[model samples]
Target: MSQITISNAKKIYHDTPVIENLNVTIPDGTLFTLLGPSGCGKTTLLRMIAGFNSIEGGDFFFGENRINQMEPSKRNIGMVFQNYAIFPHLTVKENVAFGLKQRKLSKQELEERVDKYLKLMQIDQFRDRKPENLSGGQQQRVALARALAISPDVLLMDEPLSNLDAKLRIDMRQAIKEIQKEVGITTVYVTHDQEEAMAISDQIAVMYLGEIQQIGKPKELYHRPSNEFVATFIGRTNMIPAQLLHKDGQAYIRLSDGHMIAYPALNHLEDQDVRISVRPEEFVRSVDGPIQATIKDSTYLGLNTEYIVETGFAGRIQVTEESTLDEDFGPGDIIRLEINAQKMNVFSADGKVNLLEVI
Candidate 1:
């Protein structure tokens, strides 16, 4: 396993900067995910680490060794592409043995290594089958086994589960995480799927445009987001417009419908406009709650019922409640919504400053 470090990395395309002054340290033997929307330079950064792209500036290091100019084959990194790039003509065992054969290992050692990885990936039963005869998940396992047969110092995956169905994607993500833990190889995964990143990553770097917005554990980023962009991007949030008011050394946010909600008396900027971020699950249906709303829509999602409520304070807020067969709410039904103060986040009107910082 190797600790990967990137400092002041820059990438340019036709003089336009795609990745600018990027710096991140991926710990050894940890699954670090680079998460962002499309064209956010995540794949670009991954390719740069794999020596597939040239760095415009800065250094890329693997555990104190400078590899800025090293060839891709010399990087000792195993890469799993999105489409499971396996040879159509080669059987599973043959494909897994390709890397070992390239290194000119002895016949016994090569066969042993290939067999070990085939079993490790749970594709041993289909070792004699070609790619055409295997399922998508099976093909993915073969690709992973091939990558791991050589025992690389680092494993890089670029949306490796994107091609699978929803159920298969979930199952394969768990398998990938388990295999990564067992192998203990330094892994760098790039994906735009927020749920996948949160489910499998040890640490996630949320990127936007060409910059990293925040880096933290999944729970930390989801619960205590630093800004509006981080809060909205990480999960579903209702951005409610509010005004900060100060009264006798206390700071509170006044809603549009004349509701005054006491907040942490941290940054007391009187008469300043702010936006409050509330998660869907943070609102509760109460009889005497402070905020009043009417249900606009309801979606029954097996375990939980999602309601879109039209509130007087905010325009439309989504609330998720645990489903109870006895209680049913429909559109136009009046309901009271109460916010969980501890779980709420307040940001500047421009969505740059996290007001909780002063708390």
Candidate 2:
């Protein structure tokens, strides 16, 4: 496995900057996902790493070697696209063996590698079938097997599971993670799906407008987001505006609806405007809670109950309840809401993480 480094990279197209001074270091043998919405330059950054786009500044290196000017084929990178990109006329065995054949390996070596990867991908039984004969999931596996068969130093996947059905996508994520762990290949995955990135990534970089907003482990980013954008983008969050209320050295913010919430004083913003980010799961149903709300609506999901509560202080808050037990809420039901301020993330008015002040 090889570590991929991109330092101060810039990409411009038609005089428009797509990515600006981007810096990311993907650890060796880890799944690093670049996650963002459409037109946010996640795919552009991936293409640059794969040598499909030119970088105007900074350096890109695979291990110790500078690959900023290297050809795509010379980068020793394996790429899997959203579409399977399999040769329709070729059999599965030939598709997987194409890279080896290009390098002119002997017949016995080719057969050994093809057989090994086909079995590894669990598609050995369909080795002789054409692309049309295989299901979408099977074709995706074939694409992955072909990419892995070449023993690439780094693997780049651009939403490889986007085309699969929901069930297949979930199943394939497990398979991909296992295969990546077993092969120990450094991988850079680009996708906009938050759950997908959270599920499979060892680390995630949330980007927006060609700039990286935050980069960290899944739990770190989810639990303690660096900014409002990261908090709102990575998952569902209820952003409530609050005023910095001074207290015993620590900062306390009163919600707009008149509920006061205390925060750690480590981020010492005094008498400044701030906001509190609370996840849906952080709220509870309680009679003596600090906040009051009426259940505007509740959706019954199989595993959880999602409540849209109209809070007097914050407009609306989404609360998720585990469906393992019976729910006591429905539409238009008045309820008292509880907030766990300890688990809240505080952000400044300008959207940056409020780490300098205690809340």
Candidate 3:
């Protein structure tokens, strides 16, 4: 099993601790992503796992084999970088065969392996062309093909799709997801793009300020984030300050308009001030709804029409609804809204902990 288990990993630069006490496990053959903003030590952690950076403390293991002191080349891991590091002097086929050649595989076996990934990445027709002759997406495919041709135990991708255009990035990400599933190689993908990570990963570890805030499947992270950062970073949310009141042995949040919404999730804390994390989609537009709002701005984007609305007490918040020809709301238009209490998240006033159970 090529599962990756990191235990109490620590990385320090000079006298500053960049990452400390980080523990995470990547199951075999699953596409796990380390996602966060820039300067958050995600790349640092990825390099540590790749053996390019020294682990100041803790164990880095692939199954049972410890790799902290191992050389990078001997780690049996394939790395694809953001720049698509295919040798420009070599043809596509030659680039795909580079690692196999380094291992001194027989010519027939090398050629067969190269051909397999070349076709798997669907760059076979461009096998004879140099890197410059390929489009950005095609070059990325060449890089992926080259990485997989060696049949490594694990694959590491660091923003491999960041250089491509938005449209091409979407296309290439879908391709990468399908290919990874087909090959079944344990992959650790690093990217700052939350949408890209959500689109492609089987599980994602959301990193923040050198620490992992949450790790779970895409939907789990989105619908039930562990903290305010994950709730705000993974997607857009309106943070409304409210009071958490315990009445009759149940938890509840009171809105500015005196509307109380029940929170069924157990938080084990006493009644106190809390914040509500309501996604734009969680706000329902109802003619007889309790919440009243005035439209500040609106943008129509095909399927969904988004609005910036101001309520009596919640200031300004985003609201989204399906676009319709007859129900278009513009500036100064009054509307009634209701919160989807079942989906909205209640967090502590300090934004450190969610009031609901988080796994």
The reply for model 3, stretches above 4 Å from the true place, is 248-250, 266-269
What value of lDDT does candidate 1 attain over all alpha carbons? 0.92
Q: Write model 3 residue lDDT over 36-107, tens digit each, in one string.
A: 999998999999989999899999999899999999999999999999988999999999998899999998
Tens-digit per-residue lDDT, 1-359, candidate 2: 69998899999999988888999999999999999999999999999989999888889999999999899999888889999899999999989999989888899999999999999899999999999999999999999999999889999999999999999999999999999999999999999999999999999999999999989999988998888899999889988887777776776778876677766553355587877888999897787887778888888888898999887775678999788664567888888778777788778777787454334
For each candidate in the order shown, give its overall lDDT on alpha carbons: 0.92, 0.88, 0.92
Cα RMSD for candidate 3? 1.4
lDDT of residue 166 for candidate 1: 98
Candidate 1, residue 285: Cα displacement in angstroms equals: 0.8
Runs in model 1 lying further than 4 Å from the true structure: 265-271
- The positional error of residue 85 in candidate 2, measured at the CA in angstroms, is 0.6
Tens digit of lDDT per residue, candidate 1, span 53-138? 99999999999899999999999999999999999999999999989899999999999999899988999999999999999999
- As for lDDT, the candidate ahead, 2 or 3, is 3
